[model samples]
Target chain A: MVEQHIASAFDRDLEAIQAQIMKMGGLVEAAIMDAARALETRDEELAQQVRQGDKAIDGLEELINEEAARVIAIRAPAAVDLRLVLSVMKISGNLERIGDYAKNIAKRTAVLAQGPNVSESAAAMRRMAREVELMLKDALDSYIQRDVELAQDVIARDRDVDQMYNALFREFLTFMMEDPRNITPCMHLHFIAKNVERMGDHVTSIAEQVVYLVTGDKPEDDRQKADTTSSVPQEV
Target chain B: MVEQHIASAFDRDLEAIQAQIMKMGGLVEAAIMDAARALETRDEELAQQVRQGDKAIDGLEELINEEAARVIAIRAPAAVDLRLVLSVMKISGNLERIGDYAKNIAKRTAVLAQGPNVSESAAAMRRMAREVELMLKDALDSYIQRDVELAQDVIARDRDVDQMYNALFREFLTFMMEDPRNITPCMHLHFIAKNVERMGDHVTSIAEQVVYLVTGDKPEDDRQKADTTSSVPQEV
Candidate 1:
């Protein structure tokens, strides 16, 4: 009976730690959306919100690290638990980096907002952002539920994001070449596309982390094959 | 006496691991230099040589990872020893990624060899490549020697690499716009510049790992501030 209680207590702590990760994920997901939305609507206030959330993400990372250390110190978790904590640590770093990228996008977006949005490319950019936002959401869901198939689907979708970003980049280049006046805002838009592409990468990182959580193999090798061999169509 | 023997063995293993890291660092440093030289001279065979070294880098990373795991399982080291192993595991990944970037630059450089040198921005690009190569060498030295000042210097120098890349990028964009024939090679050159920039980033990552090895506290944030605030000029 005592052993059962101890096991149950350990389970509870693991669940709590997982819950904290989910909370941070939720906040970061929102930050990505809000950051992009700020860019689209020129809402500096929303960009401010995204910047403010960065510290919370940092605090959540600290909490997760400390709690994982305590669990390892106290419970001496075995293989599966050990893998889970390790995945959480690695995935949390990716998430924090995604947050930083979101902040970077917002800062540049704010500067871009000062200009006229007369170009036709902004509409295509909005569509690209929406798709990236959905991918981020689904990737986080897959992580929380440990859904390998969903994670794979997220990986498959990254090609679409990459293609869209490339097209948008080409179009932006054309716009910039037409007039030097378009250079500054066009560069901001270019970075926004790059950030969204990078955000997709972070989601892919999360997907890979989920795979590692399920299986011990690193996903790095598999990704190269998918990148080189897959024939997925562009979405945006 | 028993404690003395175990401590001595532990120290020996650490020295062995450090030696291996240094060995791997030498190869990566050489690959960086050769890749840049190949680009400067358009030497396809030398580029291929850099590409071949990537496999050796992979082997080294695998060896280091296995050694780290074995040490953890057998000796169950604690405190500073554990931190050193952890830092090595992380930094080994950084070094391997740097190797991959060198391979990438070589691949792009190889393609550019078939064509005439980009007439407009080749000088700026050559300068950028040299600066990046030196930064990689200095960063590796910092890691092997645990020279904090040297690491700081590497970080500060990254700003120069970035500035050069930015200038090259703008110049290349103009070339691409002026002549559609230049687009393919210019894009390849752009990727080469980006690869070198990324190499500088990996060096900084290694520097961070070294700082963590020496100080125990995560020095990433402080290093970022010092690199930007101390010596590097701020640019708009």
Candidate 2:
């Protein structure tokens, strides 16, 4: 009976840790969205808010890692439990990195806000940002619900973001070519697209972590071996 | 007497592993060069050489990891010793990834070879490839020699590569604008520049690994607080 109580308490602690991870994910997703919105609307203050939240993301990453260490030392989790802690560590790291990239985009947004006539370029970027935001939300949802199918959807959706990014890259390049005066803003747009593409990669990484958490196996092999002829799909 | 024998044998094994790492670095560097050369010269045979060498690089990475695991299990190394083994594992992973990226470039070269004329676009890509090859060489040199100065040079030189990439990106944009027919080749050029940039990043990761190996502390604080500018320098 005492042992059951002890195990229950440890499980509760792990649940708390998981909840914190979800909270951090929510914060990061909001930061990504705000940064994107800031870029779209040229809202310098919102961009600054996203930039400032980076420290909080970093703090949460370190905090979760420390908690995980403590749990491992005390509970000595095995198999699935071991996988869960490891996934959390890696997932949180990826999330923190996503936060960093979002901060970078926000910084670039702040710079762009200082300029004029960003609406056209910003609209194109908004399309990319909205898709990436959706992926991030779904990936975290997959994690929270332990839904492998949702995670698979996130993985499949990454190629769409990749294709969108390629198209946007060409569009930005056209803007730069049309006028060298647009170089600075084009560079900022390029960075935004790059960050969003990386955000997709991070979301894919998170989805991979979810698979490991649920299945105890890596799914990378299947994806890596995908046919080379298959171009990433396009969406309206 | 028995303890002394075991200690001497362990030290000998450790030295052997170190030698193997250096040798693996040489192989990786060669692969990067050959892959890039194959692209520049359109030498399908050299590209084939890189393809054939992929197995060797994969084997080396596995060997390094296995040896590190064995050492950790048998010797129970702590502190700097622990850091050294960990560094070995990470550096080996970095080298393996470098090899994969090199292989990717080689494969792209194969595709480009299938095309006629290949254009000045290919030339631009070749230049980026050469820069990446140089960075790979310098990074590994720093790792093998433990020359922080060499690593610092690499860190600094990465910026030059970045600026060149940005310039090339601008140039490619113009090419694509002049003719949308040029988009595919331009896409290839962009991939080359990106691969080069990532090669620099891997080298820096190696540099960081070396620092951790020698210092037993990751330079995380330096990274987070220091110049968060473009990862590479911005010199042409």
Candidate 3:
């Protein structure tokens, strides 16, 4: 009976922290979506909301870390249980980074507002950001359900984001080559594109962590990178 | 006496991981320097070496992680010891990221090789890389010695790196505006500079981890950002 009591208590503690992680992930997903929407629609207010929302995301990361630390201190969990807590911490850290990139996009959205409209580039970025946000959602679901297939699916989707980024990168180069006046706004748009692409990378990392949490080992195959094109100008 | 023996065993386990963390840090520092040197001197061989050295850095992260995991499983460490182990893992993650950024710089150096030589900008980026490498070394030292002052110093230096990046961002814009031919190489150099600045951010994060490990509390003040200036063209 005593052993059962301790096990239940620890399980409860783990569940509580897991709930907070999902909450943090939800906020991050919203931030990504909202940042993309603001960029696509040029909605300053929505961009501002994304920026303001990051404080909450940052707060959740701190709370999750504290809760995980508390669990380690008190529960002294064994191997799998400990990996659960550690992976939560790692996932939350990655979520916080994704949130920061979203905020970066929002910030650039405001600046790009002052310059000429790169509507086509904004549309491409919005698509990439949407893909990342969905991947993050699936990654969280995989964690909650211990579904390795879902996690693997999220990992596979990162390649699509990379291909989108490369296409947009080439397009931006062409825009700059044609018109020097397109330089500044194109630069801002490119940075936002890179930020979204990086956010996708972090989401992939979180998905990999989920697979590790379930399987007790990292994935055998390394992450496949589809980004071979360089910053080199294809035509001068 | 029996309890003390177990405690000493945990300490030795931690010491072993800490040593590996420092070793990873050293390799990362070397990668940063060599990448910068390769850029400045246009030495393809040295740049390629930096790329190859990343494998060793990645291997160390895996080793440090496995050792830390072994200790946590066997020892079930208490609050302080557990925090020490977790912090080492975090430090190693940050070190690996720094190594990756160095690899990115090296990769870009190769791309820039095929384009025109931007010696002035390479010199500037080299300076930024040097600052980040020094900060990373001190961060590792602070972790070993538990020196809060040194860690804080490292954190403070990140602003200078940001300023350098902003300066380069502007210079790259000017170059692109002056001659269309400079566009491709300047873009690559700017990306390399951004990567070095990001490496400094990771180094600062490692410093923050050291402060938390020693003081048992994260630094209350958030990291200051000095990279407010954007790639926006001035006065059109």
Model 2 chain A is weakest, by summed lDDT over 10 consecutive residues, at A227-236
Model 1: per-residue lDDT, tens digit, B1-236? 98888878878887788788878888888888888888888899999999888889888987886686555545656666666766777778788888888887787776677777776454566676678667777876887788888877887787777777777766766675676556556656766777777777778777766766776657544234211211111112
DockQ for each model? 0.21, 0.15, 0.48
CAPRI grade of model 1: incorrect
What's the TM-score of every candidate structure?
A: 0.81, 0.72, 0.95
Of 2 and 3, the candidate ranking higher by TM-score: 3
Ranking by DockQ: 3, 1, 2
Q: Give the CAPRI rating of model 3.
A: acceptable
Residue A80 local lDDT, model 2: 62
lDDT of each model, Cα atoms only? Answer: 0.72, 0.73, 0.86
TM-score of chain A of 3: 0.96
Q: Across the candidates, what are chain A's individual TM-scores?
A: 0.87, 0.90, 0.96
Interface RMSD of 1: 8.4
Alpha carbon lDDT of residue A49, candidate 2? Answer: 95
List candidate 3 stretches off by more than 4 Å: A231-236, B231-236
Top candidate when judged by lDDT against the true structure:
3
